[model samples]
Target: MTAFVLVSGPFTGGEVWREVAARLEESGAEVYPATLTGLGERREAGGPDTGLETHIEDVVRLIDGVEGTELVIVGHDYGIHPVLGAADRRPERIARIVYLDAGLPQDGDAAVQLVPDEEVRRRLLDPADRDGGTGWIDPPAADGWQRWGSTAGLSEEALARLTGLASPQPSATFTQPLRLSGALATVPTSGIFCTESGMSIAKLEGLMTLGMPQFKALADPRVSFFDLDTGHWPMLSRPDELAELLLGAAAGEGHRLAAAPAQELPGYLRPFVLDVPEQTRERIGRVDLYLPADPDGAGAAGANPADAAGANPVDAAGANLAGAAGAAGAADTAAAPRPAVLFVHGGPVPETVRPTPRDWTTYVGYGRYAASQGVIGATLDHRLHSLADYPLAAADVAEAVELLRADPRVDGDRIALWFFSGGGPLSADWLSAPPSWLRCLAVTYPILAPLPGWQGVDSRFRPVDALAGAGRLPVVLTRVGLEVTEIAATVEEFVAAAEARGTDLQVIDVPHGHHGFDTVDPTDESRAAVEQAVRSVLGHL
Candidate 1:
């Protein structure tokens, strides 16, 4: 018979897993629900000194008392710390380790490091707020339970029971680093993701495609995934389902995510929809300048035939602008410097992505389409390769702008900056102080604010805060209705701030579109929205 050891998250403890444990026991499995040192029934026995080591010892003692060899250890949220530490020490006696809606922590990771909210983390780190010198962290208020994790599917009665049983967590439990001997590296593992809490197997797979080193280990063949439709506390909201899933997890049966396929061009790098005439591409530093075709119509001066033939347009807006520019006298158009749009691609993209963002089809298509419109189009590769590289990335963008303006073909004073994805925050620097030459600023599906737990991000990169200082700079924003919740919240915050300040802002809504809609959702609505936004931006220029 398989033996199951259940571990609870923060605050409430072994009592919280009673329902799930009962179901497991009824199914003929031996179940042990562990309450760590400062929580649940053990709350009175703990004091300020109870920490991660104390908790790990608590779990180790329970494991030592078990009379069987087939053991499955499950940990949820903060409970994973002790579970992992104990499992590492007793690897030979364990069958499998199940991560029950928890983060995958490594050696030396403290529970405090996993707290996502900056303000809450600050309070936890503050010695003055340590429960009046008791060195205990208070449980969240009943009304603020959602801050810990989504309380979806929990009835009023269940919530009240949870709140009433909560106990203050010892400060040392969060601050003490977990130690691991790395003995359980090859142990079978299963991850239970709570979809409603913003984590899903699909999202993890997408993140893995970015080539982030930390996520690569998840692709191990011994690991599997199971997603629950409810929120974080599945033991409370869906005990029956959680119990059955745990059984299957112990048997090493669950969805196995396929390794990310190797491809020449990933989905994000695919060609855009709208088709248009291409132009010459000039490489200067990290920037790629796409100039309009030569006046004599022999095609662009230095254009690569292969790339030009493959170039596609991103939106119909460029065609309209091109027609308007064509109506003017050729001689006059040829003699004058052209207005420019500097396209900034977004990401804390892993430095491992080949060809970089500038070479991606979306930016290339947009650049070529702008050139087709008789305007100078430019794209550049910046150093936004990590969350902590924002300042360096911002500096790279500033330098790129200067280089674009210095080109004689570009009308320096009439340039606009078009930002995308994570690149949206870079606009904060320009918006905080609108330069005389900046005709317009455009952003699409942007991240206007720092995401939760994004450490080392400079505070200056908040576009929502910068709006108050933006004078009359015309801003065009393209937003998607199906955006990720965290990113969508940032966009809403930006819109609210823009409205409050009466900033010259135009919002183009793509009601059914997703982030990177121009490339991903190639629907008519996405195309039209992109066209409208580009036109508004061109009008400002």
Candidate 2:
């Protein structure tokens, strides 16, 4: 049978791919999500550091069967670490490598240097900082992150089990720079962006405060890109769309969007989804394109994912239209440089949607924010048990990382992550994984206490404890309330605890300040706090 392996990101296991895998199988692709050591139910409580190499071995061993089986290696979020190594070791056995909104090693790169979300990098590597080359992990907090977070959609139950499903990813995973011997250089690449276009409070907070970019960028030669309207947890919010995209891409048919024709319809304006260019006919890749409906089907020659939904290409070949008026056309409006802000919404309840695909939210915003002082922003969609996915929201966040990590405009070295409420715990857990190219960790109103009786939350690795003490990467935090007390009360308590813990913590209590006040009202009391958080990160970068 044709072989495909789905790798897990931080705060997640291979089970998250159940639906996606099933869909692929239905379409005739043998798929399996790799269960690495110390992950999921079969974790490694007492083992060596589960660095990138360890996970790579697990994937390599899983596919040790079937001669000449082309391995379609799919990695999500932190899972990108292993996929890169696997690609290096078994490039010939693998037909293609799909990022699934996951990060990939750039030129002569390491997982630590892949994408530049500095904040996220610190969180993932927190464990490594405290531990001495040993395995230390933070528990997944998918529920806490969604609950107290300003997210727009989610059920209470899904919030409860956020951490329970997650295992402590080895601390070495982040510290051990990924050494791909040139895997991606020769493999076919595809990227998919899950956009959570919502008017939720939590999401709005990320948009304004963090200043994450609205649009993402891509410049790799062997890559293809696409965009979908969903949260960080697309599997839950937009599973069918995600499955369709994933399956089509695997078989080489993905979102083949194109620019629509100019007069095909009345005055209509919309953003064209961005993605990589299509390569071979058998390989499908996506990037949003608004191809106006052509009466003569002029632009139909681009690509399609079959009859399900064909790509509409506008007929801009001949006649003079809009800006495409024949012999030489030019003119446009542009903007400036602001730190790349990845607008990460709190949880399932809401998603932080930005304006477009041209900023910080893409590739962790190091290049823009660090050198150019530009901002990259993004929104949230992936969460537990919101629409379809349960206990997989963390993986979705990882997917977002993958999507933005390779953005052409983003400074992979200075990327960071921002979150509050229900997303706080999840963000903390991710931080516990290992260090990435990221530089700092800015958490507002995070969930420090564990969710009791929440079967969904589990912590095989104590990420916070592992990250505790000296040597741990920098962790900047701000809490609006305590884990169990009033929201404002909890924020105060968290701030205090953060200070005592030696973390760069800041908590605010605005009379009318709630969970997402910062995001919705950028000029509100939380503005200074958010600004401080962003600036503090810049210090290290």
Candidate 3:
């Protein structure tokens, strides 16, 4: 037999778990639904002096009194704090810890820090701003319950029952930092994500790919995940399903996320589809320059001069290539300075990947393809190795642009910037204040806005907002039909903003395409789309 302990979130109590508890009891298991101090029937027993420690003690006492050898503690939302604190002190008694639509907190993380609203978090963290200075945070009214979390799938009666049982929570509970002894690190754990709340197993897996330390830690064998297709309050919205999931969690049965492979390249690094004539390559500082071939075949061999002994070219243009058939005519007229296209590869790419984005087949292919069209092509390796590294990445991009302009072989006054994937946001800086020399801007499958939980992203990184000031700059946007929902939403938002601002934007739709369609899909449509976009960009230049 297993004993299940249910801890409710803020303003609610054991009563909120009644539906789920009944289902669990019917399965011949012991159940204990905890009502913390200052909530539900215990509302009158708490005041300003009540803090997180008091609630933690309440759970610790419950754990001590429960008569069972197999114990599973379930924590929901704000209730996770007391549950974690108690579990740390009684790890031996707990067989599993199930996180029910809750935030992952580390040592010294206060509950208020998890609040998304700026004003609410500020008030909760400041004792002086608490309810009448009594150190109490009032619960939301029945009609205002959505402010807490999504109320989807709940009936009118369920909402009334919830509000009727709600009570004020102590401000200290929100402000007090949670401490851990790391005892529960090895305990088997399950995460039940509420999909309606904008969290799901897929999103968690997506986050893991970003190479964040905290998300990477979730690859532990002891951790499993489940998704609930309902709102945050599953007890009221889907009690039977919640009970069954809890049972499965106790049995250590759920989807396990495999740790990222040690040496496998991510999907974005796949080879590009289009086969274009190779151009001569020159290695500059953090940038790879591809120069077109001379008409007289002076430098027709596609080899890097720098690679040969003492063969440094005076200018980036001195390098040469054998132009493709159609491009020869343009190269014949290239005695004047040549226009340039700088391809910015997208990232948050892990620093561990070999031959970074600049060397990857896709980017190298694009650079060579650009050069074959009678223009200089440049690709760079920027430092967007993590979500928080945006500022540094933006600075690296700025520096690369200057380097491209300084090259005597390239026409600095006729340059176009083409951004891909995560590199799309870097275009916001240029769009906000288009320079006279910047002939055009292009993006393909770009992330125009920050995704959920992209903390510390600068406000200036919003491309949709920047469009209002983009003026008459020619903008080319290539959108795929089957992009991830989060990324697709940002693209739609950017398009709408562009239309609203009457910006000179040209949208190229790939109706049957997916993100990274150029490399992954490889159909004729993909090749055609790539060719069309490249032509449109060059036309602007």
The alpha-carbon lDDT assigned to residue 29 of candidate 1 equals 93
Descending-TM-score candidate ranking: 3, 1, 2
Q: Any runs in candidate 1 off by more than 4 Å, and if so which? A: 41-70, 84-94, 104-110, 113-118, 125-134, 175-187, 195-224, 227-229, 255-261, 268-418, 422-439, 447-472, 478-541
Cα displacement (Å) at residue 143, model 3: 7.0
RMSD of each: 9.2, 20.0, 8.8
TM for candidate 3 is 0.64
Candidate 3: C-alpha RMSD to true structure equals 8.8
Best by lDDT: 3
Pairs with steric clashes in candidate 1:
none
Clashing pairs in 3: 293-321
| Tens digit per residue, CA lDDT, model 1, 1-541 | 9899988888878889889999999999999999888788888889988999999999999999998566999999889999999999899888899998887777766777666444555566567774567778788777878877788888888888889889888888887888999899989999998888777887676545434344656878899999998987888899999999999998888888666555534546766756655667765556677878767876553243325433433322222322222322232434567789999988877676776787887898788888877788888888887664577789888877877666555678999999998898899999999999999999998999976434335568899999988999999999988887777889999999999899998999999987777877778997798778777887888
lDDT of 3 at 391: 70
Ranking by lDDT: 3, 1, 2
